[model samples]
Target: MQVGIFQTQEAAADYAAAHIIDVVGGATDPVLGVATGSTPLKLYERLRAAHAAGTFTLAGKKAIALDEYVGIADDHPERYRNVLRTELVGEDKTGLTDELLFTPDSSAPDPQAAAARYDEQIRALGGATIQILGIGSDGHIAFNEPGGSLVSRTHVDVLTAQTRTDNARFFDGDLAKVPTESISQGLGTIMEAKEIILLAFGEGKARAVKELVEGAVSAKWPATVLQMHPKVTVLVDEAAASQLELADFYTERWNARH
Candidate 1:
């Protein structure tokens, strides 16, 4: 794992965007696995800015969503698909076509089968160049809550109380409206990516960031699984890196690289 401690969120976003652009520039046909949530919003914005500046483009790129709430309507504003559309795929952003942006339909006749098929689609596309992830407050990645099986494949999983509470902010504070389950790409599925870029910000994420960067690999903290990946870049602002004991070492290493 390579940890980058940026002075501000924008700086971190900019730094992360550079790596993503590099992947796009080199790949013959780039495919990305994207996660939804506030943590990655700034990174998506930075990518959009790069597109506007003519530094990069998503015209021929394909993407797969990391997860989706199990019972939401496709058009629901809070649905992960719609959120990605409005935030990253619309007019001036990623500009990815509907055919290239693969997201599971929660209302499908056979949801589990849909998930399995989604995984196969990713495999057929030659896997993701780099998956962009946002760590949940409880250390969950995508919707794989704490204690989830590390080698599990794409499937349905129950959302933990902590995860629902964290996601309730997107449902207009109505915790009751938050879905109890979600179809998420498993840790095993996520590990298939050629590389992973994870972002975290604010004091709320400090403990999770600390565990992800330094703690032992355990199902209890799903993000710890990244420690086993061959390539990973963890970007966090100072507040989020506060609990990491090796923060200074990471900083010095990153500084020397420049």
Candidate 2:
């Protein structure tokens, strides 16, 4: 596990964007496992901007979402499908194409079948060339909430009221309308990625970031599983590094490593 603390959001976004482009630029079929949340918005914009300038490119790319609301229609404005389309794949005339996408739609016969098929589809990219993540206040990755089996596979997960509320803003101020369940890639699956880059922003994420990076590894904080991965990068702005006890040390150490 490696961590980098930056003084500004721009610095953090540039670091993440460069790593993602480096990973995608070299892969034959880069399978990007995407997340939907406020933290990654800037990173997406940076990637789009870089692609336009020819600083990086994702030609012939493919991807699968980290998760999606299980009971929601794909047309739902807040679904991960829609978020990915708007954020990451939105650049007009880019090499990123619709043909390279796969999502969990309501057409699945059941949540289990949908999950199984999703896993098979993702296995095609040498298993996620790069995966972008957002940490839960409770430290979840994807929707693999705490206490879930680390080796679990894709399946429907009942959302805690907190999870629902956290995601409700995208639904235009309707927490109650947020889906109660989600189809997510299991912790075990996400850990299979060749490279993982988890981003957290804002002061609100400080504690969660501290716990996942410097605290004990525990299922109760699902993101703690990152410590066990062969390759992982935790990128954050100063606001999100506020509670880290060795915040100064991390800054020095990360600068040296990078």
Candidate 3:
């Protein structure tokens, strides 16, 4: 795992975007596993800017969402699919095409079966070449909340109370409106990615960031599972890296590399 502690959020996003460009540019047909929520917004913006500058293009690359809310209309603004469309592939955003962006069917009659099919689709496309991730304040990743099976596949998961409260802002600050369930790629599925880029910012994420980078590998802190992955890059601002005991070491290592 490579931990990059940036002094500011924009710096962290810049590093992440450059790393993504390198990976995508080198791949024959890159598959990007994308995540939703406020954490990745800056990174997406950076990517869009890079594309507009002609530094790189995402025209034919495939993007697979990490999770989607259950029981939401396909056109709902808060729906993960629509969210991705607006953020990464809307009409004006021409880098990634709409036809190639994929998300789990949240509105399917049978959500579990739909998740299974989505998992198959990922496998058929050749697992994610690079998976983008964001850790929840409660240490969850891709909605694989606390206590979820470490080796599970794509499946439905119940959102924890903390998660719902955190997501309420997206639902107009109404906690009750947040969906209780979601179809998410499991830890096992995410681990299949050839590489992973995890972003976290703000003091709110300090505790989780500490656990993910320094804690033991356990289901209790799902993000800690990344510690076992061979290629993982963790980017964070100072506030988010506040709790990491080895912060100086990470900074020293990063500087040495540069």
Candidate 4:
């Protein structure tokens, strides 16, 4: 588990984006697993810029969301699908629409069946080619809150109160509207990714980031599971890396590798 600290969001995005570009640059039809929320917004923008520069095209690439809120319409501003469309697909002008983005249809009559098929799509990637992650303030990855099984797969999971509160930043400060339930890819599903680039910023994520990279490996800090993966590149800003004891050392070594 390597942690690299950037001076600002732009720096972090550039570092993370370059890695993602490298992956897409080398693949025929890369299967990318993406996450939503404020942290990844910048990285998504960088990807848009890269695509505009004639770097790579998503014409054949596949995308999957890390989680989806239940009971929300696909057009809802806070919906993960909407977020991805605005931040990633539409922004890139890649002509990648719903056909390319595979997310569970919450309004579908058979949500369980949708989840089952979602698993099959992810498996078709032979696991995710390169997954982008954003760690929650409580260390939750996607909506898989603490105490959830580590080797779990795509399924409905209850969101933690902290996660709901933290996610309120996206819903115009209305905590009550944040969904209590979400269909999320499990820790096991995330671990299946061939590589992962996790981006985090702000002081709010300090403790969770600390626990994720430095503390004991446990399901309580769900993102801690990344430590077990072979190809994980974590990009964090100074504020978010504050609580990580070896943060500076990690960043110094990372500078050498990059």
The C-alpha stretches of model 4 lying farther than 4 A from their native spots are 90-92
Give the 10-residue window scoring lowest on summed lDDT in candidate 4: 89-98
Q: What is candidate 2's local distance difference test score?
A: 0.81
Query: What residue runs in model 3 are displaced by over 4 Å at the alpha carbon?
Result: none
Please provide, for model 1 over 1-258, each residue's C-alpha lDDT reduced to its tens digit, 9 standing for 90 to 100: 899998899999988889898898788888888889898888888888888888888887898899998989877999999998887785588677777888877887887988898778777887788899999889999888899899878888899999889888998999999999888898998999999999999999999999999999999999999999999999999999999998899999988986
RMSD of 1: 1.1
Model 3, position 125: C-alpha lDDT score: 92
Error of 1 at 122 (Å): 1.4
lDDT of 1: 0.89
Lowest-sum lDDT 10-residue window in model 2: 88-97
Q: TM-score of model 3 relative to the true fold?
A: 0.98
Distance (Å) between predicted and true CA of 244, model 4?
1.4
* Colliding pairs, model 2: none
For candidate 4, what is the TM-score? 0.95
Top candidate when judged by lDDT against the true structure: 3
Taking the tens digit of each residue's C-alpha lDDT, what string does model 2 give over 1-258? 788988888888899988888787777756777778888888888888887887765556787788888877757777778777877564452356676766765446588788888877777556788888999887888998888887777777888877888888878878888888888888888988988999998887898999999889888888888888999999998889899998888778887877
Per-model TM values vs. the true structure? 0.97, 0.94, 0.98, 0.95
Residue-by-residue lDDT tens digits, candidate 4, 73-122: 76788888887787767535654566789887777677667677777778
